[model samples]
Target chain A: MLHIVNKSPAERNALESCLRVAQGGAILLIEDGVYAATRGNAAENHLRDALSRFKVYALAPDLEARGMGDRVMEGVATVDYGGFVDLVAEHKNCQSWL
Target chain B: MSEGTIKKFMFVNRKAPYGTIYALESLEVVLITAAFDQDVSLVFLDDGVFQLKKGQQTKGIENKNFSPTYRALDGYDIEKLYVEAESLAARGLTEDDLLVDVTVMSRAELGKLMDEMDVVLSF
Candidate 1:
């Protein structure tokens, strides 16, 4: 499954809720959720912790748009929209955490 | 998992507009994905109905009004908009209070429609 979180952890509990129920799948951050990919934000530790159990990915366009492109934590992979479509295809289902 | 397959895509909107960016950004995704030519539909439920509320005065906020774009959705071949009856009633809103024409249905009916979808994206 692909767990898509579109909220910034600073603004909502969507990311936390998603992490709890993710059960070893790919977590794709898009929209404002790309803020979580920043190296030293409040959500960084949680995202780092998630890397051990699940594949973490962020939308490249969103990250660049937010000016956090270079601040992404080490292990989170960045993908374009075409890559996003590919991830959706690879996963059996998707759960969007708003 | 295959390319060239058309899927039923339903975008579930549950938040109010302006207060946050979800509503507008979700609309962005809906417009982008519609180019894929899938079976697309949209549902306005909970505070999301407020997004379509008539007489929005966004001029005070200095944000460019995006509500007008909702009117152009049909041009993208994405028009199956739905409003939850219970949500509308809870908010004391009638279909006449909205900016667009939509089929108002019970939550149960919406659930059935949801079950028929191949993909569900909520914002």
Candidate 2:
């Protein structure tokens, strides 16, 4: 399963909830969810724990838009729109933890 | 709606009340869905648990205190209210702080329940 989270962890618990319920799935952070992929955020430790279970990715454009491209935490991959489509195709199903 | 056609509907509420319109709009939709006689359940997580908090006074904000409507959900037969335990603890709230009776479950339990739903609407 591909779990897509778009809400910022600082503002909402969407990312937190997705992490808790999702077991060994891909997590693609987009929109404000990119905040979690950045360094020194409150959710950084939680995201680190998720790295052990899931392959996490963040949208390149969203990170750039927020000027956080250079601050992305280690182990989190960045993908473009085409890569995003490929991820959707690769996963059996997708859930947007809105 | 036909008896055989009723689907399991779960409404996920994650926003705080008064700060935004999502809570009120979601409540209206929940009430309307109840009219159709579907198997409806409401999940209050994150800041959404605040929606069920008791003794909400909105007179200063000039907003109608809709927290009372949650207690009236039983009359509508929409009593499957679930609150996330972690969310309550993070917000310094307990089951006793809420206006209505609700099953407090862990995130894992709620996630399993979500998987069983035929349809889920998030707010």
Candidate 3:
């Protein structure tokens, strides 16, 4: 599994690159990525299809801070600090998108 | 052994996109390395989170806001995303305000994750 941490638009391309290699993977949203949760956002739609049945997660803390926790799209789970470590253990590799 | 090893690669985005080329240029490298079949992931922290915001107008700045490009990323197969929890709290940003889905790890945890990676690239 692989993890992507995109906080910028330029970094999104990197996330796109990772989708090509994703076999068993997970996508986590934190920091600025929380903005993707907005209604009709294009990035959110793209991420949904890119993961393709793979696990997708986001940070609740970030969501709440930005006042978007309740607005996050469904299907993607939210992970906490401990869950973050679990992701590291679960995935063979991790990369930063930004 | 080194040549065949499929080490996990991670990207840490520390700055907002647009003003500096580091984030955008670093993104290009991410795609290039993925084409090489490297396992990759991404993290957003500090001002880096600003890259994913919505409704940004770059007209006045004479630059194109790159946030919309994030939607096209799925076409390239790059979707694994992450963020730094403390950073978000410090910045007063929430998942709802972000542009994508990702995991929020603590600073210590994020650092530890990097230690476990075969490759760690930050922009």
Candidate 4:
């Protein structure tokens, strides 16, 4: 399964909730959810914890929009909209934690 | 994605419309995915039930009302739309309150249906 989080961890607890149920899958951060990739943000530790259990990805356009390209955590892959479609194709299911 | 590559695609809608763009964007993707000829179904739970509410007045907000689009979904051959019964009851909504026809099911039934999907996308 692919888990997508489009909410900022600061404003919503969806990210935390998503991580708890995610056993082994891919995580994609889109929209305002890209803030999770910003280094030293409030959710950095949780994002780091997710890295060990699942492959993490942040939408490239979203990161660039927030000017967070340089600050994204290491090991987290960056992908475009095309990549988003590909991720959906690769995974058996996608759970968007809105 | 290709001809005859049909897969069971489930879209789990859990957000209300207008307050945010999630519901609208999610609908857009559903339309696009349907064009690919995939077997698609939509499950409306929680605030997502609001998406199907009749007589949504978006003119006050200066937004083109898209609620009517749900009525045309069947023309696209995308007809497997389900609403969680408990969610509707919690919101004090009945099938008569919605604009389109949908199968109302229990949470357990919906969960089992979800497990049968090849892909599940939510908003």
Best by lDDT: 2
Off by over 4 Å in 2: A10-13, A21-24, A38-42, A64-98, B1-4
Clashing pairs in 2: none
TM-score of chain A of 3: 0.76
**Mind giving the per-residue lDDT tens digits that candidate 4 earns over A1-98?**
78889989998766775675446678999999999988989999888987888899999999998888888988789999999999989987778887
Better of 1 and 3 by DockQ: 1
C-alpha positional error of residue A66 in candidate 2 after TM-score superposition, expressed in Å: 4.1
Candidate 1 per-residue lDDT over residues A36-90, each given as its tens digit: 9889899899899989878999999999988888999999999999999999999
Q: Which clashing pairs does model 1 show?
A: none
How high is the lDDT of residue A60 in model 4? 95
**DockQ for the candidates, in order:** 0.15, 0.28, 0.12, 0.25
Each model's lDDT comes to 0.86, 0.90, 0.68, 0.86
* Model 4 chain B worst lDDT window (10 residues): B107-116
Clashes of 1: 0
Where does candidate 4 stray beyond 4 Å? A1-94
TM-score ranking, best first:
2, 4, 1, 3
lDDT of 3 by residue, B2-53 (tens): 5766767777787887778877777788778777667777777777788776
Question: How good is model 3 by TM-score?
Answer: 0.52
